[model samples]
Target: MAQAQDMIRLQDVTFAYEYGDPVLEGVSFCIPEGESRVIMGQSGSGKSTILKLLLGLYKPISGEVYIDDEPIGPCSEQHLGDVRKKMGMVFQDGALFDSLTVGENVGFYLIEHENLTIEEVEERVRQVLKVVRLEESLIDKMPEELSGGMQRRVAIARALLATAPKIMLYDEPTTGLDPESATQVLRLMHQLTRERNIATIVVTHQFLDALAIADKFILIDKGVVAFDGSLADLKDSEDKRVTSFLEPFRASLRLMEERRFV
Candidate 1:
C-alpha cells in the first residue's frame, strides 16, 4: 500500500530484459519521508533492478514508478534528468572516478549540468563533505588514496551533495568495510535520515548492522516481496522463507545479551 507521504513508490511494477523472463512482477512498495527502508535478498533476486527502476534507467513493462508524486517511468529522457534531481544513488562499489580528486567527483554533477563557478561548487562540496564527517583538506585527494570506508563516505558525500536529494538510494552502501567502519556507515545513515528527514532506501544482503538502524525491512525473494514490516513483525513471522533469511541476523542478536548496546 502506498502512503500519502511516500517519497518513492512502485505500484504493481513489472519488468523484464530483452527476450528474458520477468525480473520483477507486480512489485509494490513505498518509502515514506524520514524513514530508512532496507531491502535484502539473494543475488539476482531483482533487488538492484528495483533501484534502476526508481532511477528511471529502465521503464517497467507495466504499472508505474513514482518519485515525489511524479510518474517518472514514462517521462522523456530530457524530463527524467529533472525528475532525478530529487534523488541520489550510491553504488555498491563506491563508483568514484579513479582519476578525479574527491572534490571533483562530488562536484561533477553541478559542474557539468549547472552553471556554477569553481568557487560555488567548492563551497557546496565542502559543506556536504563536512556533513559526511570528512575533512575539507581531503578534497584534493584521489579516490585510490582513501581507505575503503573513506571511499564509501566520499561516495555518500557525493550523493548528498547532488541537489540535496529528498530520497537516497544506496546499493550495498556498507559492503567491503571493516566491522567498525560498517557500523559507522550504518549509524551515519540513520543520523542522516532522522536529522535531515531524507527518505532512504538501502539495498544490502549483509544486514546485521542494518538491523540496528533500519526503520523497516523488505526481503525480496524470487522477484517478490517475501516479507515487509518492522523488526518485531519480522521476528514474529512464521513464514519459512522469512525465517530462513533471519537466521544469521538473529544469531548476531544473541551474541551479547548481557551488556547494553551503544
Candidate 2:
C-alpha cells in the first residue's frame, strides 16, 4: 500500500565533494506519492545529486533527508536497505550485466528477493517483456546482440519485475535513442506511471521528455532551484532565462510535428 504523505522530502540539505565547496545548497522538495516529477537542469546543476541523496548514496553535511517521513542517514544501513526495497532505479547506461542474458537480468531481483522457483521467475520475466513489447525469444539473446532501444526496454522490464510498490528513479532515460525510439520510451514511461500510479522522478536535460509525462516539474540552476511548478506555469513565465531555455526546444518540437504531417 502507498503512504499517505510525500514519498520523499529534503530539507535544507547541503553537500560538497570537498571542504568549502558546495554542490547542493539548501535544496528542498517534496515528492508526493503517485506524483511524477521531472528534475531539470543543465550539466553540473546537481539534479543527479538529488537522486543520489534520496537513494542514500550521498550524505548531507547539514540538514535532513526523508523517505516516507522517516529520516534518512548514511549510517542506517539496515533501515536504508528496507526503504530501498520499495524503489527501483534505471541508470543512464541501462546497467545490465554484460554476461547475463535478458531473462537472467530481469529475473535477478526476483531470485534475490523472492524464494520463487525458476518456473515462476521465467513466467514473470515473460510478462514483463510483454509489458515492454519485447518477444519471448529475445530473452535468450546477449545484451550486445540487442539494439540500443531494445537494451533500454530490457532495463525497464527488469526494473518493473519487482512486485513492490516501486518508485522509479530514472537518470537520462532517453539520452542516446533516435527520435522515434525516444518518443516511444517517453510514452512508455507515461503509460507505466499512469497505469500503476507509481511515483517517478525523471532526471533529464530534455524538456520535451518532461513535458510528455510530468505531473509537475522542478528546475535546478547552479546547485539551487530556479523554478518549481506545473508545466503551464513554466511555459507562461516571463523570466528571460526560462524563455531562452524553452523557446528553442518548443520550436524544434513544432517543426518535428509539422514534418510528421507532410
Candidate 3:
C-alpha cells in the first residue's frame, strides 16, 4: 500500500464568499493514495466548496490545500497550471460541449496539451473510451445523441484521458440516472479507483451513491465534519442527528418487507 502521508492533504482549510461566515471551517483530511472517499452532506453543507478549493478555483481564507504535499495557495500561475495537470475533475452535469462528438470531447484535452498526431490522439481517446465501456461506434455520436447515463460515462472517459495517477474529483456523479444506471456508475467508479490506483474523492448528497462505493466516508454538516469512517461504522453511529437522517431509509426497508408483492 502507498504511504498515507503522501496522498491528497488539506491543512486547516477555510473558505467563504463574503465576510459574514465561512463555508468550510478548518476542514482537514488526508486520503491515502488509491483510496476512494465519499464526502456526503445536505444542501449548503459545503461539499462542492471543498472541490472548488482543491481545484484552486477559489482560495482559502486561512489555510492551504495540497496535492502530493505541495502547498496550493497563491502559487505562480504557471505553477498552478502545472499542478492542475496532475488532477482531473468531472462536474455534476458532465460538462460536455453540445457541439462536440463523444470522441472530440474526450480528445479535447490531448488536442490542447499534447503535440501528438491525429492518429495518436484518436488512439488514446479510443483506449479511454474502452475503460468506460463506450463502444467505437459511439465516437461519432454527439452528446445530445446519448442518454444521461452515456453522457456521464463519456465524462468519465474524458477524465481518464488525462492519465493522472494521483487524484480524480467527482462532484455528484450519480445525480440523474435511473436506479440500475446509477448503480452502474457507482460500481464503475469503484472499479476505476482500484484499476487506476488513483485517489478518488466524491462529493454527493445521494446516500445510495455513498453505499454503492466509498472505502472511506465522511459526513459534512453545518460547515463542519460530523463523521468519518467506514460504511459499517456510519450504519451503527449512535448520534441522534445521524440516526434521524437515516430513519427514512430504515423505514422504507421495513415497508418493502411488509409489501413484498408491490
Choose the strongest candidate by TM-score: 1
Per-candidate clash tally = 0, 0, 0
Clashing residue pairs in candidate 3 are: none
Query: Candidates' TM-scores?
Result: 0.94, 0.89, 0.91
* Candidate 1, residue 228: lDDT: 85
lDDT winner, 1 or 3: 1
lDDT of 1 at 130: 86
Q: Per-residue alpha-carbon lDDT of model 3 for 1-262, expressed as tens digits?
A: 2244556888888889876688989888878777888998789989999988887888999988888788889688789888887778999999998999999999998888899999999999988888888798899999999988889989988888864546889998889888677777776788877777788899887775566677878888877778888866787999876776677677554443332111
- Predicted model with the maximum lDDT: 1
Query: After TM-score superposition, what is the CA distance of residue 253 in candidate 1 from its true location, in Å?
Result: 2.3
What would the TM-score be for candidate 2 when compared with the true structure? 0.89
Report the lDDT of model 2 for residue 19.
Answer: 62
Cα lDDT tens digits for candidate 2, 163-240 = 455578899999998877877777777777777767789999877756777888888888887787887788787877
- Candidate 1 Cα deviation (angstroms), residue 223: 0.3
Candidate 1 residues 127-225, lDDT tens each?
A: 999888889999999999998988999888888887688998899988899987887777778888888888999999877766766888999998889
lDDT of 2: 0.81
